[model samples]
Target: LLNSNLTSELLYENFLKTLLYSIISTVPSCVFLFINGTMLFTLRSKPVFRETCRFILLFNLLLGDTLQLAQSQIHFLLSVCRVKMVYSLCIILSMLANLTNLISPLTLVLMPLEQYVAVCYPLRHASIITVRNTAAAVIAVWAVSSLNNLTRVLLFFKFPFEKMELYDLCSNIALILGVMTAEYDRAYTCVLFVSAGLAVIFSYVGVIVAAKSASTDKALARKARHTLLLHLVQLGLSLSSTIYYPLMMSLSKVLTRMVFLWIQNAFYVTFIIFPRCMTSLIYGLRDQTIRPVLLYHLSCRLKVIIRG
Candidate 1:
């Protein structure tokens, strides 16, 4: 029995280590990819890019991603290292994650809407999506997201779990799943997912219809379509994380905790990393202006390496 207990402990520690390594590596990579690409683009592109509605949207999305990843990392540390986070700190991290949960998909929805306006109403797009208005939209998104998650956090605090010994032990998805076992938690989760999903779907549909009917320049139409498609893909990826919550809950009942944790790590590696990397690659690095600047940097590095 003692040997068996030791073996179980070993397995748990190994699983925690694996989760830590996976999150630390992949999440940071995604965050840095966005940061580096955006900074590079800003440096390389003219003042015009900074003022564009699309760039502002992208910036807000990246900001949301960074906050989400940072909170995830803290949760991972608390989980894997078995570090005890203060009750308030843990709650704050959970709230931040909840905020990010909304911001990402909402930002994605905005992207296609912006594209649709640019494509179907080119003459009026500027006036419709001015920088001041775009900034207000972003602020509104943040405000709405916070209030929604704040409701969840308030509901969470009323639970008796806070008095339990294991309350401090829970973090990351585990904490999320634990709190979500309540009926109200599930209701809120479904509401968040369904509402965001519908918004993205409606936005994409509008963009597609506009793209098809627009008598605009073919190249412009194609670019608009491509941009909308990218947003669609990103939104799908964002929603996958939401889908994962229910999945992890189901699988945990059948699997050992260690095995379930490993499975969660696998999901993160596959789903989360892909969207984060692809967003930077498909949108930021692939921008016509940004691409040339990237190539120039690559060539310069190659020349230096050859000389060395």
Candidate 2:
């Protein structure tokens, strides 16, 4: 009787802890969703944002970030609730999540590259980073990410899915069953990050070198350097997301199940959800053009809630 009572007490305590963690995870997600949605609206509320090269790029970044954040939170909730999904539906959700996850870091490279051109090649900035070209670059980013996912989706066919129609979870690792597919994912992630890091590095060095030039606008060059630095931080956060699952799976081997659950919840908030929301905060605080408008939208939202 005593053992049974203690066991029941412990189980009840764990249930409460999980409930608390889920609430904690959801609160910020809701806040950021509101912020991201407003920023998206603000970006389109004015002609300058629509016409400006940087603003269009910002819109693309936020759009991906916002969509991915929603998808990620939903996935997290599903996992927490122990909701099973059909394999076909899981593939679609996981693919869309992966698609949006790649967009921010990929699009991030272009934004600061725009800064580099404006600072290093002032004469050609207008021609090089026009809205049309920026749009093209956005399209190209989506195309590349989509193609990569498409390849993975095709590779998934190699696995015998005719047997199991329901999946315990929906994720890249959950869907990608073939040894070749997993290797391809790791190889692709490594190549993607290395190439992007190189491009951003070259852009960083170019801006720094331009900063030394007497003819370069010191203030603009300085801003470009700062912009490059921030993008690097954002890139680092995005890279951390890729490692979250593998790291958790590795740690689960040694840790106790309860401890693993605790750590996993914390890491999910830190890596998955946090990184997705960082873009909005970074741009909202960093850009002069976006600051007032973002704040206005935020305040108006609060006011509406207060009145309601």
Candidate 3:
């Protein structure tokens, strides 16, 4: 919400500006979507990925991530078009976004905990992280996230509104309609991130302890340590996104409209898309098993594009 809507210039008033932005947002998103799709396929293409517990977890994480990217692009495009959706439509879109977004961190927890067992409890890793158990874990992740979203939906109705179809810009921030809902949301997010953070930290510490053992393969311990650090970095990026809008809203108070617009786009890439892409990149490029197959599929895509 700018104080001066049109004192001098519009951020994207003309056709060229609109087209410019649409291209800017869409191109990278499309490339990443393609990459994510390939990664998902790669995870399933191999028998090893199917049988391995870690790959199963990675596949589950990628599923949530791919859907979130699709939904997030929709949200970003709507905002860029400066479209004001009706309240009902906004609620549905935003809720869907939240539902998809919640899946990552929840899945993040499971992935690390699985890795921890693979590293720390190596003897029991196979028996404990069986295919059946992995399926159950995936189900529980969705169930918890769904329950959280359901509660969010219920709290949404508690807000008494002037109109059911009032027009407003749709965003994640718009979900805070009532004081009670806001408080609940704030509390729940705090608890969720903190718990997730602690769990990842616990896994990291356990891996370090395992690394100290003479029986431990130093190479495996080093890889696990690096992976946990990547997870922490991912968590940091996810946490930054939760505050992205509010931080931009604050900047809008001081900055010129044009500058603010530029910064917002940069920030979106930094805080949101980068973290999402990091998962695929780290796994696809770094993991020995994934790298060869992922490269083959990606090269196939490149060849098709070249031939076209």
Candidate 4:
């Protein structure tokens, strides 16, 4: 009886470790998703911006982030409860999370590219980034992301493990891949690190060049500068997370785990928390149109409470 109890205790401990990581990762993501959703809805209602492309890009970003958050939540619950369901749901959610991550970065990359064209090639920008073109680009982004994620998910579900029976098969896949192809994982990490770094760097450089060249509208230049700064900070956080992910995944020693946990916490705070907080701050304080609308909605709610 004591032996059986000990075995159960050991298994539970192992399960808890994975569950904790999933929960910690999911909570902040959910918070950010909520904030992004609120901002997207607010932006959609307003006609302050004439550039539909920018709106669409932002909307897609929000959607991707929300999907990621939802995926994380489901994964966390599964990890904690050790629920074994049909393989189909597991595959679908795993694919969805991977798709969201892929699309988020792709959309992020496109945003700066669009901004660059708008600022640098103003004469032909309107014609180049029309509604039809934007729609096509978005469709292409989704198609590529879905296919890429599907490949990874398939690889994950096919791996075999004997010692640790994974209640959630999707996680089993990730563990197998992580262990079997560490180099492949590292290479993927490097790509994300480099891509995010390049996007942020080039975007800011373009913004700086535009601000420098624009001698006439001082107000517009100032606003552009502020926007550039905000984007730079956000991208910097993203780059940091991308860099940290590989290191955390590869490290093995006890000391390394401690260090990795601290780094991961920092990454979460910066990338997940800071972006949403900054978005709220920027729109609330800087954007004249959004600020008034937000206030009006709040005031109406408050009036209803007072009257009741």
Candidate 5:
């Protein structure tokens, strides 16, 4: 069954790229998990960070990203080793990926709405959006994302993979997600994407208008505007890969194995890791409460290092 005509050098190059990429991604994955844990601890005791809705959203977003990163590395290892994923494991990974990915954008969409409520409805903000309410919202996001992806999982089970299901790359997994659920997933994804996109856009637009209305506090207005812009930038990055799943399906059909591997690597760096890293970095730098706490901890660590 093996391709006897193919050269061993080609196989070696592919393995080398996969190994290097796995290492590169693993470093940041570990860093983000640490940052997220620190942020979670900072939220627990700091009244200021605890009360802020945006920081809570960021915390959950980072948590989701951490899980996604972990799953990605697992898949990468499986690919590099050329291990065939069991049917049950593939389904589990597919569900986990769906859960994490959906939670992020949905959390992001809610963030702008949270800001809009705080900015536009200051008098009612406390009554409507308390700490309890924000926590409930995050729970609800997880619930809804699970429900949405559950449909796909059931569909996936209904029509299982026909072959041995061996894969040497992440793209292969993605292709499975796309081709297997092509009929239902496209419509579902498009609708879900469009609705969330519209909500984010509208919320940000309202936030901008409300910020501009506060002409007396120019500095506050400027900061609000900048924060809204950053959220928009992050949202754009998140959705830039909105159509990529389906695109991967098409690419796999046409491209050669090596060509697809390079393109897949490019997409992973650009779409997968970029947004996850930048969004957390933006939150860590932009949030007043988080930044000081992070810096203080960093300085303390540095001092201990010097003393040692």
Candidate 6:
């Protein structure tokens, strides 16, 4: 009886650990996505800036991030409830999550790339990254991501997991998706992870080089540097979390697992909760447009309170 009780406790503990890690892994990304999306939209609304390729890329990136947020929420609810739904629902959400994850990073890579091109090749930038071309590129990104995820989904249904009592059926479906198309899925994920990282790294490097060499206005250079730094931080956080999935998937050692778990949790706190907590601070402290907008909104509410 004592052994049985101990065994039960162990199982429950393991279950909780997995659940906690899963939540920590996904929830923070969702929160950050929403916060960044809001910030991007606010930035877009400013009348001072022209609608350029960089702006278009940023908008598409936000849309992709928003999709990812929805996917993460769906995944979180599915994990917490442990409810088994129709296989179709599992496949749908899994595909959606994967598609969003893929597209978000791809589009994020493009934003900085577009900015680099615009800054470096100002003469040809207009023809090279027109609105029509930008829209087509965005569409191509979604198409590729969607098709890849859909193929994974189709392959997942071919796997036989007849007797497994899955704690979370959604996770089971995701696992099936991974295993059935393990080679392709792993390859695609790695490629995207590496490509996005390289793109961001090179884009920023180009930005830095351009900033250094260009005989531009000091104020513009200062603002560009600040913006680049903020973007680099965001990109670093995102890439860290994105790569973590593959790392956790590949590593098997207990100590390594523990370290990864800690890092994963830290990533969540930094990216997810920190962003929401710091959004007002970021606006008030950093962005010119956001500061006045925030102040106006606050003042309007205060006036209403005083009148009441």
Best by the lDDT measure = 2
> 2 or 6: which has the higher lDDT?
2
Worst 10 residues of 2 by lDDT: 167-176
Q: Give the Cα-based TM-score of candidate 6 against the true structure.
A: 0.66
Off by more than 4 A, model 1 = 1-46, 166-169, 172-214, 294-308
Clashing pairs in 4: none
Clashing pairs in 6: none
Backbone N/Cα/C clashes per model: 0, 0, 0, 0, 0, 0
Of the two candidates 1 and 4, the one with more favorable lDDT, higher being better, is 1
- Per residue, candidate 4 scores C-alpha lDDT tens digits across 1-308 of 99999999988976776566666666776655655556666667666533478767766765665665465556545644556765555656666666766666666667767766676667788999887888788898898787666667666655653434434434323343545354555566567556755775686677667767754244654565566566666555544534433443454233454455445555555554554345455545576766787566556655776899
The CA lDDT at 283 in model 5 is 74
lDDT of 1 by residue, 1-308 (tens): 99999999998978767666666555666555545455545543666667877878877887676566555555545554566655556666777777876787777657777877787788999899999999899998898888887777777767676464444434544465344545665676567557656665666566667666647666777777677667767777776666655675687689985677677667655655555555556755668865666567556655776899
Of candidates 2 and 1, the better by TM-score: 2
**Tens-digit lDDT string for candidate 2 (18-78):** 6876797889899899999999999998899899998999999989889988988888777
**Clash count (model 2, backbone only):** 0
Worst 10 residues of 4 by lDDT: 165-174
lDDT (Cα) of model 1: 0.67
Clashes of 1: 0
Which sections of candidate 4 miss by over 4 Å?
A: 1-33, 47-51, 80-91, 161-164, 168-174, 178-182, 214-216, 242-285, 295-308
Q: List pairs with backbone clashes in candidate 3.
A: none
Q: Top TM-score: which candidate number? A: 2
Give lDDT per model, in order. 0.67, 0.84, 0.80, 0.60, 0.69, 0.61
TM-score of each prediction: 0.77, 0.92, 0.91, 0.68, 0.82, 0.66
Q: Give the higher-TM-score candidate: 2 or 3.
A: 2
Q: RMSD of model 1, in Å?
A: 4.7
> How do the residues 242-300 of candidate 5 rate in per-residue lDDT, one tens digit apiece?
55555666777899866765676667667766777776578777777678887676577
